[model samples]
Target: MATSSSRIGARLLFGIVLLFPLTYANDNAQFPYALTFGSSTLTASWFTKSEGIKAIQFPVDSKYRAYFEDALASFGKRIMRRGEWHVMAGDELVPAPPDTHNEDTAVSLFRDAAQQVSRNLSATLGFEPTYAALTLSSVFNQSSTKAATDAIFPNGMGFIHSIKSLNKVAPAACVAHRLDLCGNLGRTPAECADKDSISNLILVLEYEKEYLYVDLVFVYSEYRTFPSVGHEMLREFGEANREKLLKSMSTYDYNRKLHQTLNAFIESLVERQLIVRVDIRAIVVAGGASATAIAQLRKLAHNAVGNGVVKVVDEIDPGLATAHGAAANNGENDEEIERAAEDENIDDDPQSGDPKETCNNDAIEYIFDEQQPQTFDGDKMKEMYYDKDAWVSGFNSLMMECTKLYIFADKYSIPQLRDDITSALVGHSHGWGWWPDPDIDIIELVYNNLPSSSGLIRLLVLFTAYSWSSSPNVIAWKDRFRGFHPEYLLDVLFAQAQLLENEIHGEGGIPYDGMLNSCVVHEHLELGEEECRERLAKHSYIFASLLSACQAANA
Candidate 1:
């Protein structure tokens, strides 16, 4: 009795229903395993819902270790050493025959080694896992690497890689950024820029079953031990200077290029609406140089994005993470599984209010003295307690007091008090003297007590940046800069750059006067603009002259 279209729709629905169980069955039957190809070792892992995860290392017998080491040595000696000067041409390097031939041979040798390891793993497990995944070290060229992997695992899922596996293990709504810091061969063009250079070298040598720091020097294209170079440097230059040197090295061209690559990838993903910035939660570091790479990448990420939330996960067994991650990627839907578990634990009762609501609706009650009955009563009370004249006489004590109050307010969850203290402190910083400088104590207090996102912190940084030229105290704090939070220092540098940029463009310099605008430092909570303005009207007289100057400058 149904129409032709309705009959077609019914048939399609029935077909989908019938196929659903078959698809699920296939997923259940899938026993995915992964093998990670590394310079010194081969790592394999398999995952099953019932069994969880099982990982094994190849070259179980010490003699077999030579095979992997020789393959890697050949890759470095033949491909990397020669490919350094070669040019890329549409996925093919020019001067093709010899270099290309060596590259293929190197990849094949590596693959053969991996296959032997896989066979051993399969034999040990009794049944071989058919759905296999493979992840290669950064030294392997992606185009050639894919061919090698395909050959190793003919029925492989090409899209499943270590990074995807890392994402699977990471917390929800977060993705992983892989930073492979290999030993011999530099992977990308950026890493290859300074091949085997000692300019910014860091090494961890395996000796007597313990990893020890190795400082080496490159003399006439050969590496030689510098012999306690780090210790000597520390003794000569002191810990502070050594730390500074290390920090500077983190931004070297190789690391800079890596950071830029990561930034570009993140921005592209954002542009494509694939992921937001917050979704980039972890930088999974792998390889022999992981310890060095993590420190450098942490600094770079902090500089690039202030890195408040992003974590740098140290993969102790470097290549094993990739193997385990790949094995976890089988036909299973990790997200869906997690979602289902979360749903099962969720309460049936609806939440009292939207948890994500940004605005605090609780009314902030400001009780005024009945005898005084003034609109600016709160301001007057703050002035009386902190003493405005004392701040003009010597701002240190007042600054400290205000900072403590701000910290207290933050602790007690009093946004209104925090806002009031912020406005008062900023106004005083401008009016106290020509170049009123906050000392190291105040800097430490704000940074230590409040989070980096605090407006008060931003205000203090801006004030420091604008006043640095005239403020001798701030200039003198250079020695103590290392003690300051890295994020705080980065913020200050950015603030200074912004002020300089404003001057360069003939923007007539930063409007320090504009900072007097109460609303700039005020927290309105749930109040509408009109309501916020009405509330702020009471304290408007406090910065009337400064606000007038700001308005005139803008006009």
Candidate 2:
């Protein structure tokens, strides 16, 4: 009876299972084959398997999948074609080629010139131009000797062209001292090499496209030579006369000691103009030796160039020997820098062009108040080389010098010197007003050529912004704007926006005043309130419009 009952129950269960068949269901099965979602729809295959595999495996639902795929393909095609809906169409816009200056070539030529100068020093005793190509390239990009802008180009631009020497010989005083020790003792300049005389090489570089020569004198501080003319003068005038004699002796020795060297160098430009015609600028003296020597050399250089024309430069260099090595291997302070300050022009020289024009003391009346500590202390000429305000008055005249110094700093890895120069440039611009008609070409050249990491780029941009803001007239403004590199100009525009944004958002900020008054802009538009407002409005629109135009043009 139990077996029969079990069979009957099994049969009833089978019947019930057959009537209501159980099936397994996946959650993804209910997901639409293609569900619309904005422009792009999600499909089961898109979320699950790739479209290619889904197409092959699931051919039955091809209609819905095809609809979704066709829509996606059309959308992609529309995006690639030219249309108002797309941000951009077709391929990316090509960028314009960068306008790279011939700086690499210029740097190469300059380095070669320095090497030639170094090599020729041993063989020649004159003002020899070692590199013929040194002066081949025009310093000014557009101007020449006849061009009006030619006068604006700074000399040298940091190139060593001509080399002149203050001959190698024993001092007359040294010879005299030797004679006193042993009678009838005489040493010729050749025999007494490096004995009593130190043959200092004065490199004549191009300063403001003009040659800058250092008129130096070598003095003997030892025992006196027997009754020399310089000594006789010294006896008559005391200390002042003594300086005059030393100055006189320097010129005499230059001609006497380096006669052979000078003769050899006379074949080129050195002969025609520098030596024969004497058509030159002021001679300079580098300070750093004994105070007496500096005073004597300064007087001598002044006398040689004439009192009004001569100038003194600080001992900014760390000896030519270190520079020489630096030129070869781009290395750093193999040695410490020795400071030598160049004081102001000597006052009350009887031989001066204008005796009344002399300053009683040698103190440099620093152009800007920033250079207050530059007072001359007795005989010591201790003007700081890195003083920002020191260059305020002669900003334009000193640009080339600063450039050379920067390059020198770069070659020798002198970060402090470079930083100092950067500070000086900043002070110079601020002192003279933000946009005081700077030489944009030179600044551009420097900006383009300097190392990318240099701080000079920022300074250049700041000045350029000032120039742009303060453009006096339409033509001037257009020229200045067009001068910058497109990328750099964009950067400046962005920077200006940020500055305005900061000022507008900061404490005591001007509500809705996005444009702050730049020194250049304020000075240029010195007008009534209404006129200034109108002018500023126009400038803002024009400048904003120009940025887009520049981008398009560059593209």
Best-fitting candidate, measured by TM-score?
Answer: 1
Query: Candidate 2 has what TM-score?
Result: 0.25
The digit string of per-residue lDDT tens for model 2 on 1-555 reads 000110021111111111111221121121112100111111111011111101001111333234323432332222211111222234753322322223343344333333333343222222222211011111222111112111111232111111110111112112211222211222345634544332121222111111111222222112111111110001112233434555767746643333333223332434433232132222222211334444444444434433242233322221111111111111011001011112433343322233322111112221122222223232222132112343322344445445644654554444434544554444343332333334555566666667645655555555555455434653556666686666566756765665567566763322222122322212221243344344333322222222212222221
Tens digit of per-residue lDDT, candidate 1, span 266-299: 5554586534454333344333334444456446
With a 3 Å backbone cut-off (N, CA, C), the pairs that clash in candidate 1 are none
Candidate 1 similarity to native, TM-score: 0.31
lDDT of each candidate versus the true structure = 0.42, 0.29
RMSD of each: 24.6, 37.4
Q: What TM-score, computed on C-alpha atoms, does each candidate reach?
A: 0.31, 0.25
Most accurate candidate by lDDT:
1
Point out where model 1 deviates above 4 Å.
Answer: 1-30, 59-97, 100-108, 154-281, 290-300, 307-309, 313-319, 331-555
Question: Which regions of candidate 2 fall more than 4 Å away from where they truly are?
Answer: 1-394, 430-435, 467-475, 507-555
